[model samples]
Target: MGLLFILLLGVAIHWASAAKLGVVQTEGGQVKGKNVKVSLLFRSVDVFKGVPFADVPGMWEKPKPHPGWDGVMRADTYRDRCLQVTLLQKKTRGSEDCLYLNIFVPQGRKLSTNLPVMVYLYGGAFLLGASNDMSFLGVSLYDGKEMADRGGVIVVTVNYRVGPLGFLSSGDARLPGNYALWDQHAAISWVRRNIAGFGGNPDNITLFGQSAGAASVSFQMLSPHSKGLFRRAISQGGVALSPWALQKNPMALTKKIAMKVGCWRMNEDVMIKCLKMSDPVKLTMAGKIDVLLILGKGTVMDLIEFSPVIDGDFIPDEPSKLFHNAAEFDFMAGVNSMDGHIFAGVDVPSINSKTANTTVKSVRGLLAGLTKEKGGAAVESAFSVYSSNWGSHPDPAVIKKTVADIETDFLFLVPTQIALQLHANNASGARTFSYLFSMKTRIPGFPSWVQAEHAEELQYLFGKPFSMPLIYFPRHRDLSKYMIAYWTNFARTGDPSIGESSVPAVWPAFTENRRVYLDINHKISKTSVSSDLRSYYVSYWTETYSLLPSTRQTGVLRAGDLSPPRGRPESSARET
Candidate 1:
């Protein structure tokens, strides 16, 4: 009995020693994480959740780096998300002090591994999102554990301010918005400074995102302030050139939202001070005006009202004009098969409720607003083009598809094409690669006719959340595997297919004449589609308007630039 007791005590001591091995020493303090089994046969991966990279003091202020802590901080669970409105106009669980980031590292790996890092920024139309496990609409998204485990690379998902709290602008430094973008910059800076402690190569960080997050990535690539923070970037389904990506006459919108909150319009400074003292919830809810304009009836023009703006310091010029500077970094941009389906889905209400003339007029108003009167003739020309293609259909269903197709080309495909052309023509280093995800998503609740709606590619790259169905398993698992390989390979080396793995196809660089893109379905195929329709639209819009200049540097153009009361001669050029 005495011998057996001694043996049991020895085993207990050994087990306790093994448990302490998961502790990682960060600059802030020592944090202990747990090993999570992400795959059946593979070993567990270590995840440290809710690690504070910045200290956010309430709303409307910039984030500060977290001061070092005194002792061990147990990073075992997620912290509250940053304050933002949720789906269905409900306020979700989050706080102003929510500037945390989650990190996933390979378990039992030595410090010498020095894995490449991929940091993700979630997309929510610049409104709703968090760093923890949550699905946007039906697309289950935002987990780095699977990426870290499967790809053998470190993954970090960050949280920043969203909604009006992140992007409200007084058009000056006094109450300059884009605090959300600064929060992301702070995260990147923190990673650059401290990522080496977690077995990640700080020099090789890659920034990638979808939707508004993708737009943010584009801004980062263009901003001189964000230079050297990331080595490469991947922007999916969004670009800075999209009219919806930038707000016009932002101060007017700011004053309007302030009025809704009972703060009478005064000078910009006084109004900003009044807003700082108002109820934070009321301030956040007041932003629903931008929402109504964006997602309500009429055109899909306002669907992205609260997005990133040119704040002089961060974004100097329109991204299209700034491509010469952006050509320095390696870039990859892509789109889905049915990128227009989202706009089409939104158009159902407008078509059902409004008359055809009203719909056409609403679209024309959107075109004039988006193109600043220069594209008026082009808009008239486009209506004819669509009518001829769609058989001049007066039917609402035909009209809806036509409108969706036009918007798809206008909002996503054409802008991407222009960006790729600029980058390919001017980039100093790596050649740009583009892709088209054409696979029909098996995720439940997605319409069968919808081929890869906006962000379905997220599931293929990062495994779906457990709450969602296992739609991509067994059959499409290889696609996910190759995608992980492709992404991580790009992070390690500038080229995706240059690594040791046997990638199925050789992805060619995009060029003006070729316009080649990889079509990812059951099998990956390299092909180029006829671009006659797209080329015509692109030529008209580019010829009509110059790239929009920064509002801070140029002041609000809409307030002064609109056709002057029908009496004065119009300026030769207008800012759009």
Candidate 2:
């Protein structure tokens, strides 16, 4: 009788444990999700179909509470990515109702303890991306079992509206612009309210992003609305201070896009109606949208025009000015060693000319707010420096590489560094950390010239190294493990140091004098990288180009008293 009783108790315990770790019923339907999953070689966790943070809204903007689900929800498979119209392709399905968030929790024994939360914002130049991309799976970063065995943290990835629908802003009071940013805000609010149910500490949320996502993160730091949304921030490759961050006049641009789709002269109400009436496929096709234009130029327009803007509300001032004021926040910002190489291929001179010219124009425009003389000189100096750096390389490929590297520094890296410096100088208690990802992948069929190319880190960090193009390579597991450890550690402690790893030396912080950085290669190491390049960039920005007025710098030609309120174009050249 005693043996039988013991056996019955053991069976009951096993069933209860399985139920707790598996699927749970909701108002919707049956759902199952891993309590904690291994992603990117780290013991992190993920929970899907948990709960919606906000009430659902109907097509006409009628608010409705989310109808709870029935049975357990299986969160094993990723929800479908948000709808996007790929610039290179068409006929893709994207839905307007695609707002979702995924969570990754670190493995740990005490399941009920609160854990640090890292919220990731993805980047596709603010035009294309979703939280479900294989590169961002994050299972390896927070495998539940492993996190339980060791200590744990929580990871959250969110999807925001992208492209014209999300960013288009009209200066007109009728339009509520920056919907994409609003989506992000909503996601954060959701995290604050409900993350504790999944063992996440709402007070310890860290916001991080790459590329356009990074730019968005920067904007959040500057925005009063996002003042307390996150305690720390990590921006990779994209900084909001850059000329390419937000559109100068988004409302005007949105009108242009609207006209292209036969919605010209329409009021906000009519415009939305027309947009909804048109087929999504047809609407995407009417615009001669190139990937570069969609990604690069889109970010520069006005908040109401077509991009994130200096709205008196959501975004109060330019990111540069905001950073200069030394806005308080913990930050980690850096750029890839070959950030521009992704755009520069075998064509050397042609590509170099295009890139250099565009950069010169942008630099000139940015500095116009200060003084014309200074802005022109700054542009000239920047071009001269870039040319000299590339002139040393005899090989076209090498020359292209050099030019790309210089451009990356001028456009992305320096701006990020400057923001960090400004923040640090203000004595904001927020520490600034920097890193350079230079690890070259040995993946076959992948371009050998494209070492550590844009978006390469996504695969290893997501623990999906064997997925798609990355699977063609050898040593995927090795690389994935290293990436997982670094990212997870950063998510946990706001520092990426891994003491137990075979990897070399601790990554240095970007302090006042000694600007230490981590060079992530085949093996990670600490080094004083890109100092010379950064110095040149700073000189150009401060001395040569600090004279132009903000409106002029952004190419907003203001005519004299009667000149149509704003100035006409000075030249017929393509802006942006």
Candidate 3:
């Protein structure tokens, strides 16, 4: 009798565990997932972690769909991250076999079908990141439980290759890089085909990402290979138009890596074969891999060591040339008000430098390296625009913001503005919404003076306030709720405000003439926005800097307009 009671207890425990988990059949086979509870409202979501969407890829080869599994593949755990170095450059972790996707489905009595699907791609300058919830800084970087629950959509996060393993290309057929992009393509294709089994609408999938992921989404919007794959697209903080998005003279960078891996040879086939078999760790650590001995030195092309290549197929032309037309899909993109903080902060003496000189000389040395022959002239011209209003002895905070403003405009602000304008002009009627995320972050690392530094919007957009209620104020929760509504509403009907009264104001569609853009902050309203939208800075970069002889000689794009300031008027900004 005692043994029978013990056996009954064991069965009961197993039943309870099963009740908290869910099973779904995929094209590959059956898989089990964890049932997670989210939000104060207490909704359950089945989160399938580390489900293989594509098989392990060979070096420089496109990915293939995962072979059908034999039986119920236990997918309750996150997969290994793709190989990458940490942001601090203090540590390294991950593996070559890291191509997996995590899917989150809102649990219900019957099948949860016909729900909109959102597939996310993370960004780390195309160098590092993972799809696991506990990925970045040991926090929930890619958790979709709350998003799936709150938005009533199927949320899928993907793990694509980064670093040399993902982006090193030979600039030819031998090794046309962008293996990471292909991995993204495979993951999306798999989702389009198999998401119905997970109770999602395969037809209404929205692809969105931040940083490199955003650039990847923009690339897909132009690539023929990605046609008919997604209905809506969103990019945050990065795009193909950014200086670091495409790897110019990739052949030179590839050859450098080849030599580092001891794979150099006269024959391209032999060189590639050796690289395939070389140690991945050694290849990744090709030391200072961010930009070393390369032909495109002293130019914007060398900003990032490895990135997507225009291999004639995936990206047939330069991104600027291709922006004349785009996919027939609604689009949304924005940048943090201080999006350049991370990049420009490294050069400036930081908040600690109380009496530092915020002059052209401080930035001239760096611009010389990036702008090459025209570095000095470029600095003078840009300084005239960027530091126009600074009274030479500006406060350190103001100085820091001014420095960050240059990077913000060059790397993110202007590029995003141009992208929105191009998409607006290209679209027949497809809508494009642009915004500037000015909401400050609650995360403590950033100096209080910094407003909406890069990726600050992610936490609010992903419902972080809902998860860590104690750490956030009531205002954060309210802001997060409205953001989710706008994002999900856009995914569902291509409009952020369609009967959603929670939104503070009507988001006007950006056009070439009006150039309307939302300034998202404590008060979210059209009345708070500028109609001309960075008109002065637009003229400074596009007209003054772009037409300069330096820009022409450097072979860089006409990145700036005639506006004295990068995006705002001299009276409003530090730059003239």
Query: Which one wins on TM-score?
Result: 3
| Runs in model 3 lying further than 4 Å from the true structure | 1-21, 40-42, 87-91, 108-110, 133-139, 266-270, 287-303, 350-352, 355-359, 392-396, 443-448, 499-501, 550-556, 559-576
Deviating ranges (above 4 Å) for candidate 1: 1-21, 40-42, 108-112, 133-140, 289-297, 350-376, 391-400, 443-449, 465-470, 511-514, 526-537, 543-576
What is candidate 1's CA lDDT for residue 411?
72
Worst 10 residues of 1 by lDDT: 567-576
Which candidate do you rate higher for TM-score, 1 or 2? 1
Model 2 over residues 283-389: C-alpha lDDT tens digits? Answer: 54443244353233222221212347777777776665565333456677777766655444321234334334333344333323223333445445545644553
Please estimate how well model 3 matches the true structure, expressed as its whole-model Cα lDDT: 0.75
Q: Candidate 2's error at 99, in angstroms?
A: 1.1
Residue 373 deviation, candidate 2, in Å?
13
- Number of the top lDDT candidate: 3
Clashes per prediction? 2, 71, 22
Q: Please give the ranking of all candidate structures by lDDT, highest first, separated by commas.
A: 3, 1, 2
Cα error, candidate 2, residue 215 (Å): 1.0
Q: CA lDDT of each candidate? A: 0.67, 0.56, 0.75
TM-score of each: 0.83, 0.74, 0.89
Error of 2 at 219 (Å): 1.3
What are the candidates' C-alpha RMSDs?
Answer: 8.1, 9.1, 5.2
